[model samples]
Target: MTTVVVADDQGLVREGLELVLTARGCDVVGVAADGREAVEVVRRTLPDVVLMDVRMPVMDGIAATGEITRSGLPSRVLVLTTYDLDAYVYGALRAGADGFLLKATPPDRLVAGIDTVAAGEALLAPSLTRRLIEHHVRGPAPVVGRPAALAGLTEREHEVFLLIAQGLANDEIAEALVVSSATVKTHVNRILAKLGTRSRVELVVLAYESGAVRPGGA
Candidate 1:
């Protein structure tokens, strides 16, 4: 069963999420009222996933997510917030949140999101993904350079990274490159290993932060 820690400022929200996750067969290992407490609980329990709220006292979810991710812990963070603003989405993903879903999501989808993040894949709300694409095409040219870590990637890996960074699905990437899906998957795995990212969302963040794709296309 998936193990999870629910972190939200409101007591009722915490209780509600705990109940929902529990009923879905997830092991609700712990719940915290704030980000700091959430971080502490996660470090102590080392659960598979953390359901973190964007806004909380002591430290916000973004910072807490950073703390957990940078700690080298095995836990993945899933941003479970009411807000779906671009700022929050960017902040959470850049801070290493493996998934981002609005609280208005149905319980079944929320549980599926937990499973997605637990399996080390990304789960973004459809609207959030749409917003990202819109901003990518219209947002201002951010002043940033390609990350030096990318130098470690092979030529094929770099090509794969660029495509995945633009939010293409694995099969889409394969079709674009005229390669098998398994080949694309292998390239993706190598890119992740070389870049030291845990999820594809991190890749999207890096691409945007580095201005690697630009406003038009790669």
Candidate 2:
């Protein structure tokens, strides 16, 4: 079963998410009312996925996400927020969140988002991707440091990374590159392994940071 940790300040929201996810056959391992507690729970439980709310008292989701990722935890974070245009989305993404979703998202999509991130895929909505790029561009250039983690990728793997950063799904990428979906999946797997990233969301961040693909280059 896919184990999940839910962190939200609101009791109702947390409970509702837990109920919905559990009903979908996911294991709701734990829930936290604040970011700090959430981080602690994650450290102890090591759940497969974390459904994190962006706003919380004592170390908001962004900071917790950074800490969780820097600590090299096994869990993937999926950020939940009420404001679509909130600047925190970009921060959380840079902090290593695997995906961002609106709190009002439908139950089916929310469940799918969890599964997507669990499968090492990024879950940015098509509409949200454009906004995310715009948000990043409007902010500072994020220091643009190159990490040696990207050194192991092959040319085709690099191509796949660019396509993924552009928000192309596996099928679309396969069609674009004239390769089978299975081949695209293989390339993506290699990309993730070489970069030491848990999901495609991290790949997108690396792609932008490496200048392999620009924000509007999509």
Candidate 3:
């Protein structure tokens, strides 16, 4: 069973998330009412997933998520937020959150999102993903050059990364590139390896950062 820790300043929200996750066969390993405590519990429990609220006091989810990731813990964080436009969402992602989910999401989607993140995949809704892309695109470009990371990718691998950043799934990428789905998967794997990223979410970040693709720019 996947183990999860729910962290929210609101007791009711924590309890509700715990109940739903537990009913779905996820072990609710711990609960915390503040970000500091959440970070401590995550370090101790090494849970498979952390359901973190973005606006908690005493560190807040963005800082907590950063701590958890930098600690080299095995847990993946799934940020919970009531506001879709929360600025903390971008920081949390940069800090290595595996996914983000709106608190208003249905219970079933909540459970599925937990499972998805625990499995080392991101679960941002497509709309939220687009919003994140738009946000980053609107910002001034950073001075950092593309990491030497992209050096290891083959030409086809670069193509795959661009398609993924365009929000195409494996099958859709296959169709777009006129290749088989298996071939697309292989290209995706190579892209991830070359980019030194852990998930597709990071791939999206890198793609935007590298200016390989941009919001409203083809």
Candidate 4:
């Protein structure tokens, strides 16, 4: 079962989420009323996932997510937002949230999202992923050259990384590349290792940031 921490300033929402997640067989390890408390709980409990609210007292989810990720903990953060296109959602993503779910997401989807993030795969809603990509692509270009870390990836690994950043799953990437799924998985593992990224979400960020995958390119 996935282990999780629910963080929201509202007591009702936090309790409701804990109940739902528990009923779904998830171990709700902790719950917090603010980002700071959430961070502390997560650090102590070391849950597999954090159900984070975007808006909260004492640091907000974005800052808390950044702190958790930068600490190199094994936990992954899944941000919860009430808006489909909330501007803060993008900030949370950059702060290393593995994915996000709308506050109105169905119970099943919420549980599934927790599982996906815990297992180290990305869990973006398709439309939200597209919006995020567009936001990055339209931003001002980086003045510096490609990130130096990317130099370690092989040509095949680079190809796999681009497909992953485009929101394709391992199976989909395998099919598109006409390779076995195992091969695709191996490529993905190598890509992550070479990039020193803990999860696919970070890989996506690096791909776009390094210009390996552009706005309107193949």
lDDT on C-alpha atoms for all candidate structures: 0.85, 0.83, 0.82, 0.83
RMSD of 1: 5.2
Instruction: Give one digit per residue, the lDDT tens place, for model 1 in 184-215.
Output: 87888788888888777667767776777753
What's the lDDT for residue 154 in model 2? Answer: 76
Which lDDT tens digits does candidate 3 get at residues 60-86? 998999999998999999998987874
The TM-scores, one per candidate, come to 0.70, 0.71, 0.73, 0.69
Query: lDDT tens digits, residues 96-133, model 4?
Result: 88888888889987887787678777777655766777
lDDT of 2 at 93: 74
| For every candidate, C-alpha RMSD to the true structure in Å | 5.2, 5.1, 4.6, 4.5
Which of 1 and 4 is the better model by lDDT? 1
- lDDT score of model 1? 0.85
Off by over 4 Å in 1: 139-199, 202-218
Ranked by lDDT, the better of candidates 1 and 2 is 1
Which structure among the candidates has the greatest TM-score?
3
Model 2 lDDT, residue 5, Cα? 99
Deviation of model 2 at 182, angstroms: 5.3
